[model samples]
Target chain A: MRSEEYLQKYHGVTKFLRILAQISFWLVVVLGAASLALGVATLFMSSDSFTFNFLDNIRLSMDGVLQFDLSLANITATTKKEIITTILFALSSFAIIYGLIISQLTSFLKTVENGMPFASANVKRLNMIGILFIVGSFIINTVYGLVANKIIHALGISTLSVNLQSDANMLFMGIIIIILAGIFRYGSYLQDEYDATI
Target chain B: MAIILRLDRMLADRKMQQNDLAEKVGISVVNLSNIKTGKVKAIRFSTLDAICRELKCQPGDILEYQAE
Candidate 1:
């Protein structure tokens, strides 16, 4: 395709995707907020009838007794409640971080749609996203894994095994994005110089 | 801006208006004005060649270097 054709096609796609990303970001925010509020409410409820458990990777259910799928056997009621609370907070934090990534993506796409792919703002946004992904994965995924493993070991639950592996792919992807951001900064410089030239 | 464009002095010496020089050089008056005012960071060799041909001078005559 011709350069103009490619640019036109890219712009059309960027505009459409930006709108989609905006909608998706808002949806994630609303869902994350509602889930967090519900979880917190159940955790704080003083009634004996309200029982909750975080089972598996995604252990949220709207059941009456809030019982988790994980048959956390040979643990006291207090310990079980504590574990549930930890999962609740961790998952909520994870959701918010995930939503943040999406929000950043929406903003990035908006800039692309504005026909300024080599803008300095894009470089900063990509750098921020790279940090968020790497740091968020470390804090929410790897850190949580370590804490969960310790809790499991201390509790002596051999049957239960939380995912102890960190996402190496995500870490590598973050590094790649950071590298891309640097390259983008160079591209922005060239673009500015080109525009300034007569 | 160590290399200064002496286009104004050249025009004055020739007793020619900027518009006449711009017309002879096949360039806009605004572009010639930019070159005159040192607003442009750099000038194209082709533009400088055209200006020199029209003004009957060498490149050195239109450009001068002064230490900062």
Candidate 2:
């Protein structure tokens, strides 16, 4: 296919990804709120009733008092901590995945902006998507961090004590990718405009 | 960054209006305007070939590249 047609096809796919990213973003927000609520409720619940487990690292051991045909409430404090860590890790993982997706989208937007020649409407919308990804991703990630901190504080835990074990390098890479995408998008727009006059 | 489109210059030099060229080439004036203004990011090889034949000019007469 010709370059223009190929770009048009690419735009279609990117638009789909944009929609998916938006859905995932909202999901993260909702999940973050739910997790915070749980953390707050956990603070009010009695320690004896507390139960949690992590994957393969710790075993669930309940208080040996209530032993009337019980098979569920068998988790220890260590297990609970591990479980919380796991949940935090999952949230961070989702954030990372979404970040990478937005990074790639921004890159593609830049490529389109670079004088590949598209409908003005298409070009405008693509730029808008790029802006949305950059701004929305940052907002969502920031909110996630803040909410996690709030939950930790509400549970009488030091927020800084809990660290999600995502690679900092990867996060940095995602940010860089996004920044480059924005730059490219802007450059492409200017080029497209100048080319018009030529 | 310095890619140059000379299609407009060529058309001007030939004293040919874009509409006339579009008519001669059997294409819409909108498409021809896209080429001249570089609004269209790309032109199909067939379209380029037609434009060249109609204008009696080479692709080089229409496009030039300069470094950013």
Candidate 3:
């Protein structure tokens, strides 16, 4: 593509990513503050119980012999600690993943804006995002699983269990991004060589 | 360390300014400056030919080799 078209494309993408990055930053700050507030609130209201309605339906069919439908028809009650922990876990996980991805994108777009998309800094940022996706997903899922189990036990719900599942798709995507970062690094080297050839 | 650019000396001997030579050679002043300062890694044959044509000098007059 011509340099003008290339720059225009990057300019538009950078503008969009800047907005996204700002939003993600605010969301992370708000979520962090909310988690802290919830912790403090829990300390004062330790004995209170909160009820949450299921947002989706759970369907079970066993060999056409029995079928059961569970939905908002189900409401679960839990203590203040359980509610706070669950909310904090979910919010923190979202904030962490969203913040990492957006921050990397912002930095990458800035490099492109400077007319150097194959910069060494962009490679590092891409690799950082890749590592965050892989490790963050694992940590978030594990924390959520542990928190859910603890909450279920605290609620005296003996029939329910929390199972931890690793996200293979996220891990695969992270690896691909890491590989792309390597390719970008190589591209940066080639660009340098080309520029040096006068 | 071996190849050296004598563009500045040649331009001085020809009594021509860098900008005039750059204009005649049809290259940016920045690129011509880089060539004169020996900051560039390699020179294109077309660029060398243009510079030689503009200065009315052989490539040997613009470039010299000295062992370091």
Q: What is the lDDT, from 0 to 100, of the residue A125 in candidate 1?
A: 88
Report the Cα lDDT for residue A121, model 2: 44
Highest DockQ, which number? 3
lDDT (10s digit) by residue, model 2, range A83-197: 4554555455555545545544554444454535343444444454445555555554554454455434534554344333334444555466556556665766776665543
Model 2 chain A: worst 10 consecutive residues (lDDT sum): A61-70
Candidate DockQ values, in order, are: 0.31, 0.09, 0.67
Candidate 2 — which residues are off by over 4 angstroms?
A1-3, A51-168, A175-179, A182-186, A195-198, B1-68
Worst lDDT 10-window in candidate 3 chain A = A70-79
Q: Which 10-residue window of candidate 1 chain A scores lowest in summed lDDT?
A: A55-64
Ranking by DockQ: 3, 1, 2
Q: Which structure is stronger by TM-score: 2 or 3?
A: 3
Give candidate 3's total backbone clashes: 0
Instruction: Give all TM-scores, in the order shown.
Output: 0.68, 0.38, 0.77
Model 2 gets an lDDT of 0.57
Give the per-residue lDDT of model 3 (tens digit) for A12-81. 7777777777787787878867876675665556343444334235453322455645342333443435
lDDT of each: 0.74, 0.57, 0.75
B1-68 in candidate 1: lDDT tens per residue? 68898999999998999999999888788878988988777777888899889889999999999989
TM-score of chain A of each: 0.74, 0.44, 0.73
Best by lDDT: 3
